[model samples]
Target: MKLPPLKTLPVFEAVARTLSFSAAAEELHVTQSAVSHRIRQLEDDLGESLFDRHGRRVALTEEGERYLEAIAPALAQIERASQQLRGQSDTRLRLAVPSSLAVRWLIPRLPHLQRRHPDLDLTLEMLADMPVMSERLADAFITIRYRQRGYVSTPLYVERLFAVCSRQYWMQMRESLEDAGLREKGSGRSIRPEWLSRFTLLSAASVFEKPGEDWRRWFQAAETEMPPTARVQQFSHMLLAQEAARHHQGIALSNDYMLDTASDPELVRLRTHEFRTGDEFHFACKQSRAKEPGILHLSRWLERQAEASGWR
Candidate 1:
């Protein structure tokens, strides 16, 4: 038995499923006349009418319906297989991340991602200082900003920022006090009452931009007044600020998620209480890419990682 033309079957399937020649044509990116002609030819080949005209609409006949049930799945499978093969050729996932988070959190987990998806070509790009979405440039993005309207955003975690310093800096301060004959100073475990008066306070540029919620804000949240004339050294980026703190350049306020204890043991948290801020960590992607498998996978993975890390 001779088989019907493969090309005609798709046209017929589209018409049969939609029951509208115009709709099928629009979906197939062809003229309505072409869709009608293909269905006519297919019916002639099969020796049966496929559609029953009802004024402006069409309905599939019993035979057409049965044929559709048989062929639709096979055609859909072929289309999906083609897409999957194309996807393998373009397996790269472009991710946009904040510079600070990239250096502190995501960079450390990259080895684990590679082990899980050896075939995935992962690319990481640092986001600009301000939050912006570019669909053409990134497949997904992570941001630490307030919710913006008109974008699909998923809250991943809330971060708490606190002061951190290097262990060496604490030891040096202890030695300096002992040498100055102030060894009788309060217990070395606790910060000296005049400690803020002695050392510089390092922070990111964001702190200055939001003066209401700077290092002084955290101090106020702890029910303490801002220290008078505390030395301030601002870095252009959060990672730089954290790095400066790690090297004992000065004390810096940072989020726990931005410190990799496994990689930098010298960094130690100074304040037990965290500063309350409105900023939140969220995942944002264009509505168009929301349903994509890769996007969904990464979103879920990040969520799980956040959960495991005890992020709120």
Candidate 2:
């Protein structure tokens, strides 16, 4: 019963999953040379090529895809079993964060975090489709609530959301107002807060307790009310709402972390006001594990990330 080298399995898995030798090395905390060596060894042992590399790009060979399908489930099961055995040890943490934050900010920074703490292992559970809280969901959570029965929380930052829309939408709306004789024909002026009352609002349903709550708060911050006849289109996630805004579907609420103005020149932030949601995003862990080495390390690292992002 000759099995492939046990050490090479993880290296193979990381490379197959990411399809990049450099990314797999970063994920596994090994040098790219080590990753290449492992891949060569694995291929030698298996008597098959796993990847088809074209210059700097790589794709899994047909054999590699089939191998991945077989091993991926086994790896996942092994990880789950290991976590169950490890309990609440800080070294292996299952951290949950809001989906929007995870996508826009956290995911991109993960490699750096891994680089900082090579010995630590992290599994991120995104909170878009999942319920926010439970004793068994994750070892730590990034959340809006500060107090939970058995958890101690640390604040990350208060959320300040601003209205954003497609530049085309703004221009068209301005042109319509001009046609109606509501403004000087060619003046480049900021849109008034009341103008939003007539615009379609793109709503992210995940963040609101009830429909229009966010818009209500935002409108009040601008010294106006969300008009009764205001049109609202709801998306299950904030990213979806932002995408809708980019497509000129409607105006959506967003902030700096999520809005890459340079890449998304089509999306423009409304100049009138930004609404600060007083609810601070908190990093929380069970009271018994709050002082655990892994939890403390992760918490402090998160603080640095938020500060560096200038959102604190």
TM-score of each: 0.62, 0.64
Q: Which number leads on lDDT?
A: 2
lDDT of 2 by residue, 222-305 (tens): 887888899989787678899999999989998767887876688988766787877678888878667767788899999999
* Whole-structure CA lDDT of model 2: 0.83
Return the lDDT, model 1, position 73: 54
Off by over 4 Å in 1: 1-91, 145-150, 174-195, 208-213
Residue 114 lDDT, candidate 1, scale 0-100: 71
lDDT of 1 by residue, 169-257 (tens): 86776677676765655654545434544677776866457532467776777778767777778776567777898788877788767
Q: Give candidate 1's TM-score.
A: 0.62
lDDT of each: 0.73, 0.83
